[model samples]
Target: MTLDWEPAAGRPDLLADPVAEAILKGGLTGGPEGGRKVDVAAIDPTLSDTAAFCERYGVAPEDSANCVIVAAKRGGEVRYAAVMVLAVHRADVNGVIRRHLDARKASFASQAEAVELTGMEYGGITPIGLPADWPVLVDENVTRRPFIVIGSGVRRSKLALSGEALVAVTGGQVLALTV
Candidate 1:
């Protein structure tokens, strides 16, 4: 099934973003049998938000994934994790995440905190190239899809990749993250 998004590699302009450039450089996942290869595509900045992007780009919500940064506190120390989930579902931050992080509670990172920690825009944060120490969690549902479009750590472009690629990222953990 051909998607409405144009191929990202064919357009050099979109590569200007570091995250998008890294993905093209090799952030993609494995081939079929393992997973679909990653792809990149430029998008309108106005459509960066979930609703607007899916609507204008002719992409269904399930085909797009949301990468969210969460923080938790334990004994006066702070830890973080990055989670990827389908737009159709929500991450169980307060439950599964808090337990996984072993924190008293887990909460979504604020716009400023997310941007500062990941060096990516709040709406554009992707799991690729996140701080290595930060746990990268992928909800099992995300991997079930053949292909998913995710943030490029910038609002100007999106990264397309197989569920395998996301699952294969070093230290990536798959869990039942959705409520």
Candidate 2:
């Protein structure tokens, strides 16, 4: 089916986000070596609840990946970041991520902070087009799926692609970093 985007409103071009573009381009190719085909679906931007969001799209929570932005703080300083993973597991903030980022403390990004840094509506943030330095965490469960649904750079849209294709394009590291 042909994909449809939301009405434009001074938003950045879909292609302007390199990560989104890469996923889009990857979807058009045959497979991993040739890229993967992505099926895009649009929805309401306010739907941040993963379970409800998936239900609306006729997808199970297990079939969807949630992209959450986290901020690590140390010495009274705050850092903005993003992480992507399956909805079935929570982020390993105290374990894998803390060590991965070398931060003494870390937690979910505040609503205002996430909106400001990522330039995405709270429920809509996707790892695509996120700051390059921010680490994209992939839960080990995600690798087990042949295909998964992820945010499409907007809360209203989602992309479905092969797991391998996403790994190749994002160069994301697979970790047992979920609880």
Candidate 3:
């Protein structure tokens, strides 16, 4: 489970198309060393889920984050946003999110809808390369982590970065978003 981490900016092949493009387009900066904001490692695609990936990679649940797409509806309109929380915590999607988004109802987006919208595999959706209009909500606990393992927008790989870097790249709003 020893991962050979490399700067994500240098390994575009490890990222999904939109994800690579996003990174090259201001989502990240710096070279392959100290200044790099994101890093990546290949993984078994089948172990892409948070629990399985954490177990396989020997990653602590607290050091891993899960990103889920939420479909919030207000009246006749629907909005999509990404919610990020540590693997040890569950996002407060129904309560806090519904209220924050001012939606009548809030629920996880369907698999097909998620993949189609984000252009990333359902199980590997990261907050890094979402639609420009979609908000990225990050849990306060996640932001405290010095390093975190998140999706790479593709099941076959995973990205590693600091919570602050994630927030800076996605313009994430840090909040108490756990149940």
Q: What is the C-alpha lDDT of each candidate?
A: 0.76, 0.64, 0.89
For residues 48-138, write the lDDT of model 3, one tens digit per residue: 9988888888999999999999999998999999999999999999899899999999999999999999999878899988999999999
Which prediction has the highest lDDT against the true structure?
A: 3
lDDT of 2 at 95: 80
What local lDDT score does residue 13 receive in model 1, on the 0 to 100 scale? Answer: 61
Name the candidate, 1 or 2, with the larger TM-score value. Answer: 1
**Candidate 1 per-residue C-alpha lDDT over 111-163 given as tens digits, one digit per residue, 9 for 90 to 100:** 99998888787788988777768899899999898777888777877777767
lDDT (tens digit, per residue) of candidate 2 on 58-135: 677777788778788888887765667888878888788878877889888888887778766667677666776777
Relative to the true structure, candidate 2 reaches a TM of: 0.77
| Total colliding residue pairs, candidate 1 | 2
